[model samples]
Target: MTGPRIALFAEGGDWHAARLGESFAARGAALVRLSLDRAMLATGTETGVELPGFDDGLPDAVLVKTVAAGSFEAITLRLGILHALRDLGVPVWNDARAIERCVDKAATSFHLARAGLPTPATWTTEDREAACRIVARECGQGPLVLKPLFGSQGRGLLLVERPEDLPPPEATGGVHYLQRLVRSPAGLFEDYRLFVVAGRVVAAMARRGATWITNVKQGGEPLPFTPDARMTRLAVAAAGAVGADYCGVDLIRDEAGRALVLEVNSMPAWAGLQSVTPVDIAAAIADGLLAALPQRRQLAAAGG
Candidate 1:
């Protein structure tokens, strides 16, 4: 049962990291678990490989579960190894570019808009006055959401309806990541996370929350979501917009029953989604990336 090797990039403390390793191990695929934080410093990115003590050989596929974005050395070094492994023909889930793009919410929104995907009315600006005006126009007289451009688990998010409600711009480096508060027609404002793997929708769940913030980390509860044709279409389009091989696209239904992409997560958390849906998301990802490698090779072979 020696299947292709798959590496899971996540901190040991994360349960998903352990669960993923266990899942692949049950299938006899060699699983390497490494935390982005533990990777070596920015000694260079050309062929960045090796930390002080970890060397698990180049894996056939890499699943990035968690990233330490702060420490420049940590993020850059891990990205280096992942990118290097990619160049060596090992499929890195999300790849370095996709990961980089999705990790930055601003960039993800930009790409989604460029791809003609329906995204929320978003306004990001350094000028607070202009941003405030946009928010008032869209969200109606304040109570706008100010999310950090680069944050996970709904951290550092602001719901401001007044100037006093607005924190010092310097508090978050003077960058305002604002979005119009869009409410779903459904009384609960349910949001769906469509888990796309191997270029197909594997499983999905609707997150029902009390507020506009529907992040599971922020008390959103998951429910089985059987995507309709429209839901499936939006999920696939959202994934394509960001070029993520495996992704979790957040979608919300507007009044017109139109599904608008809320966000595209490259390294999306699946434990919660899996708990609600009868699907082995991590294993699906591991298997999908493994399958893609050979197809990629065939494509490279056909010169004509």
Candidate 2:
């Protein structure tokens, strides 16, 4: 019998892809690296998607490491392919629905709020005047962080301290996502990233930035952190809220010392976390993906 074949959806030559490949290899699994941008969808009497390199057949499961950046239509179509694969009874880890919910900051916040998770107050609107009012009203009390509705790694983030400082609606591309910037009680510009796999907090790290944005890609330094019960519960709940099989849940401390969720990422890069943490996250994720294959396939086949 052949080992479970997995299609890794990530850009070629990415370090993450190499690491994941090694982990899967150790587990006696075969991984085919393919870029979603290069993958095409074919529909007919029998609908299926095709990757340029995976001509043999569709894999048993797809492990999504990254979703490439593209125009709205392109991104949607890429996610649609993942959706198609899931519909065809192939297990897609962090399935299309989960990716959609997490990629869109507004949707993630809504889900977090709905679940009564400790997330910062947030507002998303397309109306310029409405956004201005929201910024003006909220900024007077404290700073509000303006961010792209669909982005990661803390890019394109602005901390608006004054109403007049708010970018015009046209500048924001007609949509605005604003969240209250929670200040740490200790006055440190830091946050915790809890890496969760299969509903457990597998590893964690504290990221302290020179300023407010604490993303590792943004020059933040990562340090190993021990997870407390509260942190574990909040991170796990946030992941569940976004329906992610594995994810990175960012949390910050408020002035009153309460932990609040900042964001949840379905397709998270863990190099920074791995550097400071001792856990073999890649191995854990690989094991989880393999373990989920049989059950996920069963669920998909049963119309679940």
* Top of the candidates by lDDT: 2
User: What is the C-alpha RMSD, rounded to one decimal, of candidate 1?
Assistant: 3.1
Query: What's model 1's lDDT at 130?
Result: 78
CA deviation > 4 Å runs, candidate 2: 45-47
lDDT by residue (1-304, candidate 2, tens digit) is: 9899899999859888898999999999989888889888987425578876667778888999998888989998999999998888888888999999999999999999999998999999998778788887888789999999987898889998766777877777788899998998778999999999999999999999989998999999999899789999999999999999999999999989899999999999999999998899999899888998888878877899
Q: Which tens-of-lDDT digit does each residue in 32-117 have in candidate 1?
A: 77776665534464435554333545566677877765677667777776776666666677788888889888888899999888
Best by TM-score: 2
Candidate 2: which pairs clash? none
Residue 101 in model 2: shift from native, Å?
Answer: 0.9
What's the number of clashes in each of the models? 1, 0
Q: What's the residue-level lDDT of 105 in candidate 1? A: 83
The weakest ten consecutive residues by lDDT in model 2 span 44-53
TM-score of each: 0.87, 0.96
